[model samples]
Target: MSEFKQLSRSVQGLSVLVTGAASGMGRATARVFADEGAHVAVTDVSADGAKLVADEIGASGATARAWALDVGDASAIDRVVGEVAAHFGGLDIIVNNAGISVRVAIDDPAYEDAWARGIAVMLTAHPRIIRAALPYLRKSPCPRIVNIASTEALGATALHSPYSAAKGGVTSLTRSLAVELGREGITVNCICPGPIRTAITERIPEEHKIIYAKRRTALGRYGDPEEVAHMTLSLCLPAASFLTGAVIPVDGGLMARNA
Candidate 1:
C-alpha cells in the first residue's frame, strides 16, 4: 500500500506580510493570520495604524510587527519585504492588499493622475513584492501569494474606470503568475470582494449603502472585512496546494446575480 502524504491546514509559525494592513481588509487579514499563530508583518502607509494593529495582536500574545510601507514605491517594497523576512526569519506568504480608490470621469483632469496612482499601488505592487520575496519564499516548503482584487474586476460601475482597470489588471496578473510560479510550488490566487464594509465604503451614507446592498447583492448586505480575510487565509494554507490560479469571489453572492 502507498503511504499517505499529509498536508497542513494550520499557518502556525509561518511568516506573513500583509500590505495596507493598517485598517479595513488588510488589518483583518493580519489579525486573522496572527490569531492562528503566524508571525505577521502589518505594513501600511499609515504607520500609526499599522502599529496599532500590531500592538493589538501583541497584546493578545500573538506575534506581529508594524512597518510603514507605501506599495506604490518600488524601493519601499523591496526594503520592507527584506526587513520583514529578516525579522521573521523567512517569509512564506504575502498578501498584496494595498489599494487606493479612484473615482474620476475619463474626461476629468484628475483622471490621469487617478489612473496612474491606482495602477501603481494596486496592480504594479503585486509583482514587485512577490519578486522581492521570491528568494525567501523559495526556501519555504509552502509559499503562497494572495492578491486582493475586487468584484469590479468582473463587472464595473460608472466613474470608477481607474479603480476597475487596476483591479482587472490584478486578476490577470494573478493568473499569469500562478501559471509561471506553479512549477516552483508557489500558489498565487486572487480574491474579488464585493460590497465589503471597509474604509472605502464607510463614506457612503448608511441608507444608501443599505439600498445598494439590497439592490445589488444576493445576500442583501455588505460583508465584513474579516469574512474576506478568512478566504485569504484559506488560500495560503498548505492544504490548498492544488488551488492555484483560482480567482475566488468572497462576495456573498454579489457576482452570482443577474437581475
Candidate 2:
C-alpha cells in the first residue's frame, strides 16, 4: 500500500468523541476525524443538529452516532461519556469543543449570571469530561485530548471578560492535564482559535464585522472553520506523539501580532 494510504489507515477503528459537534469548529473537527477513518461520536446540545451531522457521516460510509450533550450539566456529561465509550468499545480521542460566549460588560445587570454560565460550560466542563473519560482513555494505546480554547485566553478584549477568564482557565487545565497524563500515554493539548467565520460570528453587526475583519487578524480576513479543523487533525495524528501541554493557536497571526 502507498505510504499515505497506510498512514490514513492508522486511525481506522479508533473511536473519537467531539462535543458540540453540531456546528462550527466542532462540526468541522468531527467531520475531519470521521473522514480520516475514525469512528466518531458526534455530540451537541442540539439533538437534531447532532443527528444530522452523524447521519451525514454514516451516509458517507463512516461510523458515527449522534448524542445529546449539555456540557454544563455534570450528570449529562457523565452519562454521555459513559454511553459513547460503551458504544465505541472504548474512547481513543476526545475533543472538548463545546463552549459559549456571553459578551456582557461587568456593570451590566446580566453579567453575573452570564459569566457563571460561561465559566461552567467553557472552563469547568473541560476537566469534568476529561475525568469521566480517563478510564476509557487509559485503555487506548494512543489516547489524545484536544481542548478547544480561544485567542481570548491569551489576552484581554472588551466585553469578553468572562469568556477570556474561562478560556484562560482552559489553557491552564490543558497544561496540567498534559503533565498528569503524560506517563499514562495520553497527550493533552489546547487549540486557541481566533476570528473564525462561524455561526457565532455571524451575529456581529455589519459595521463591527468590517472593523474586526480589517483589524483583529494580521491576515486581514476571518478564518474558515475547516482551517481550524485541519490544525486539529494535525495534533491528533500519531506523528504528534511528542506534543503535549502545547498551547497552539490556529489564529491567523492574531496572537503573534499581540506578541
Candidate 3:
C-alpha cells in the first residue's frame, strides 16, 4: 500500500468518542472526525445539544449517536462509555474535552464549590473516562487519546485558580498516561488552547477582549473552534503514531512569546 493510503486509513471508519460534544471545541472536533469518515459518539451534559449535533452528523450519512454524559458522574461515565463502545463494536479514539469555567476569586463565598466542581469535571473525569474506555481502546489497532487542556495550564491568571490548576493536572496526567499506555499501543497527548472564540468566552467583557487581543495572544485575535479541531484531528492520524506524551499548544504563539 502507498504511504498516503496507509495514513488516510488511520482516520477512516474508526470509532471515536468526544465528550462535551454539544458546542464549542467539542462540537467542532466531533464534526471534523465524522467528516473524515469516523463513527462518532457525541456526548454531553446537554442531551438536546448532543442530539442536535448527532442528528446533524447522521444527516451526512455517517454513523453518529448522541448520549447524555455528565463527566462529573462516575457511573454515567462508565455506562455511557460502555454503551458507545458496544454500539461501535469497539472504540479507537477518546477525546476528553468536557470542561466548565468558573471565575470565582479564592476569597469569594462560592469559591469552594466552584473549585471542587471544576476539578471534578476537568481533572478527575479525564482519568475516569480513560479507565472506563481502556478495554475497548485496547482492542483497536490504533488507539488514541486527546485531552483538551488550556493555556492556563502553562500560566496563571487571576480569578481562575481552580481552572488553571485543573488544566495543569490534565497536562501532567497526559504525560503520565502516555508513558503507561505506550506499551499497549495507545498514544496519549494534550492540547493547550490559548483563546478560542466560543460560547464560554462570549461572556467576557469587551474591554477584556480588547486587552487579550492586544497583548495576551501573539495572533492578536481569538481563534476559531475549527482551528483547534484541526490540530486535534491531526494528532489522531497514523502520521502522528510516533507522537505521544506531547503538550502541544494550539495557542497562536502565546507560549512561544517567552520560550
Candidate 4:
C-alpha cells in the first residue's frame, strides 16, 4: 500500500461511514480514516460537497464514495448504510457527526422549530443509522460507533438549552448502545466538542461570543473542526477495541471547572 493508503487503513481492512461528511468534523474524520487505510463513504445533505470529499479521498488512493442523505429520515439512513456497505463489502465503523444548530431566544417562535429540528438531527436519527448498520458492523472483527455530542450537554449555556438537551440524548444513547453492542464486539463512544470554529460558531454574535470563551476554556479560543475530528478518530479506530461507552470531551477543558 502507498503511504497515504497505509495510514488510511486502520483495523486492517474495515470500512467506515461518516454522516455530515461534506464539511467540518465529518469531512475531517473521513479524511483521517482514509489516511489510516479504511475505505470511507462520506454522506451529507449536500450532494456537491459530499462529492467533493469523495473526490479528495479518491485522489489519495483510498476507496471513496458519497451519498446525499437527510438523516432524520429512517429509510434514508437505512438505504445509505446499505449502499456504503455494498460499496466496501461491509461496514465496521460509523461516525454519527451530522447535526443542525438551533439558536432561538425565549420570545422567538422559532424556538419550537429549533428544538424539534435539533432533536431530530442530533439525537433521534443516530440510532436509526446504527440500527441499519448493525448487521454488517456485527460481522466485522472490530466494530465501532462514535456519536458527536457537545459540551453544552454537560453544562448550562445561555440561549442553547434545546441544543444541549438534544446532545444530552446523544450522550445517553452512546452509553446504552455500548452496553448492548459490547458483547457483539462493537464499541460505542461519544465526543463532546466545545464551541468549535465551524460555520455554526462563526455566525455567533460578537457580543455573546465571549460567553463561550470564558477562563473555563483552557485552550483560550474556539477549537478547529479538524482538532475535534482528530479526537474523534482516536476513539473510533479499531485499535481502540478495549474502549467503549466513553464520553470523551474535546472541549479544551471547558468542562473541567465550574461556570
- Estimate TM-scores for all models: 0.98, 0.93, 0.95, 0.90
Q: On residues 1-259, what C-alpha lDDT tens digit does candidate 1 reach at each position?
A: 9999898999999999999999999999999999999999999999999999999999999999999999999999999999999999999999999998889999998888898999999899999999999999999988999999999999999999989999999999999999999999999999999998899999999999899889888999999999999999999999999999999898888899887
Candidate 2 ranges beyond 4 A from true positions: 1-9, 205-210
Model 4 lDDT tens row, 1-259:
6565332225546798999999888899898888878888999999999999999989989878999998988889989999889888999889999988777785788888888888888899899999999999879877889999998888867888788899999999999989988888899999999878776776788656566676568766678888987877788665687889999889888887565
Flag clash pairs in model 1: none
By TM-score, who's the top model here? Answer: 1
- Measured with C-alpha atoms, the lDDT of residue 210 in candidate 4 is 66
Tens digit per residue, CA lDDT, model 2, 20-139: 999999999888899999999999999999999999999999999999999999999999999999998999899999988679998999999999999999999999999999999999
Best by lDDT: 1
TM-score of candidate 1 against the unseen true structure: 0.98
Error of 3 at 51 (Å): 0.2
Worst 10 residues of 2 by lDDT: 1-10
Task: Report the Cα lDDT for candidate 1.
Answer: 0.94
In terms of lDDT, the poorest run of 10 residues in model 1 is 250-259
How well does model 4 score by local distance difference test? Answer: 0.85
Residue-level lDDT for 17 in candidate 3: 96
Better of 1 and 4 by lDDT: 1
What's the true lDDT of residue 62 in model 1?
100
